[model samples]
Target: MIKTRVVVGVDGSAGSAAAVRWAAEEARMRQAELRVLIARHRRESFALDARQADADADTSTVQTAVQQARAVAPGVSVRGVALPGYAVPVLVHAAEEAALVVLGSHGGRSFFGQAHGSVCSQVATQAQCCVVVVRGGEVPADGPIVVGVNDDPDASTIIGRAFEEAAMRGAPLIAVTVRDGGSSTAEEALGTEIDLQLDPWREKYPQVRATREVIGGKPDKVLLQQCRQAQLVVAGARQQGALLGPVGTRLLQRAECPVLIARA
Candidate 1:
């Protein structure tokens, strides 16, 4: 049987539910098993009131989330997971066997945003597998999947994965090139320069209906606007062992829909 293993962390948020649904569809396309994990901290770590509450309540919460995924793809195998401690370590551990991890961005997903739902931020930077961030429920349709390419060769995974996702979702691929508009001279030639980089990707993923759009402006703003109603927005993790900076620190946090941070 084909196996395209995928995992997602749910915290009972609307965004997390969107991520779970997105991953379920992805697993269905890949004919893979879907694992839904919810980090359950030890009761002792919480205040006495919550600590004394029924542990089964937590288990039921996790099971409910798993059911959410199973509802989307009944044929795919589903597992409900609850671990002790913060979401990062628990999710990174799940990534040991997962091909991709899906997450949701809420409140403040940016570097300076509220830290309430930033678990995806930590996992994206450290997970062994790819991490997908979804901010809204809309999936790209009849439109190109936008990818923010960077200088890192590790970005190949993002490119390759975007093709697969676009093909599966029947969305056109739009390879976008954004240069620092901080200076006029750099801005003038950035569009043409990005087209050169998009050429090889077009050839490699030819089967995946795609085109290139070279936009001049800030990377974060351009990407956010492109992802407004997009099926998916993908970017490569920074080469420095962290998925920070524009994509990680900002874009992934603010994009309206799902954003995949594949290894670069």
Candidate 2:
């Protein structure tokens, strides 16, 4: 049987290193192959000497990332490659056959800079599979996997992924639904809706201890607060023209832990 592949993009930045570690662990847990990729921009000049130097640097970067990944996951199969192209397109193409695409929250000034907003968002929006943006400090091994729940049709995709992850990591799952009103009736209704969404997944993954919460506040703010104690946050991509909606964008930018954007 062909093993699933997890593709991760890495520069020489600390954030990319963190991504490598996270991706390695995830690949090991999923029993997948880890592909470490480094994208080198093709220079306009095309000077032979400069091109050679760029190739050498790219090779070194990818090799170093591969070593790091192997160190993190000694039993998992890992490979490293340096491709010549822009970061976003290169990763998106790789994601075509990948089970998951993992990236750092920050890619320094060159590629994955969160400040630029174009690279990460574009890849997350365009990738064929789910995208994980590794952010914040070290994830607590004991922390629960938090997932944002709503009435959207894609809620099943998000909750299903969340339960799968929780089962893989042997962690509890917390399903959260945010409401604009503080009325008791609204809270009860929202909680019931979330339970309806989660019941099937709970039965499917009986090992995962799951709970539901209905909070009255902004979606992003409430999720961010929950992220403080979460090892990972799962959110659904918008079903419309856009993929990462406002809540997903904010979590990608400011969440206290890694955010997994479940693709519809």
User: What TM-score, to 2 decimals, does candidate 1 have?
Assistant: 0.84
Instruction: Report the C-alpha lDDT of model 2 over 31-80, residue by residue, as the tens digit.
Output: 99999998877777989998998889888989999999999999999999
- For candidate 1, the per-residue lDDT at 161 reads 76
RMSD of 2: 1.9
lDDT of 1: 0.73
Estimate every model's Cα lDDT from 0 to 1.
Answer: 0.73, 0.87
Report the C-alpha lDDT of model 1 over 121-163, residue by residue, as the tens digit: 7788788888888775565456578887665666666677788
- Model 1 lowest lDDT segment of ten: 108-117
Pairs with steric clashes in candidate 1: 140-231, 144-172, 154-264, 155-264
For this target, which candidate reaches the highest TM-score against the unseen true structure?
2
Worst 10 residues of 2 by lDDT: 107-116
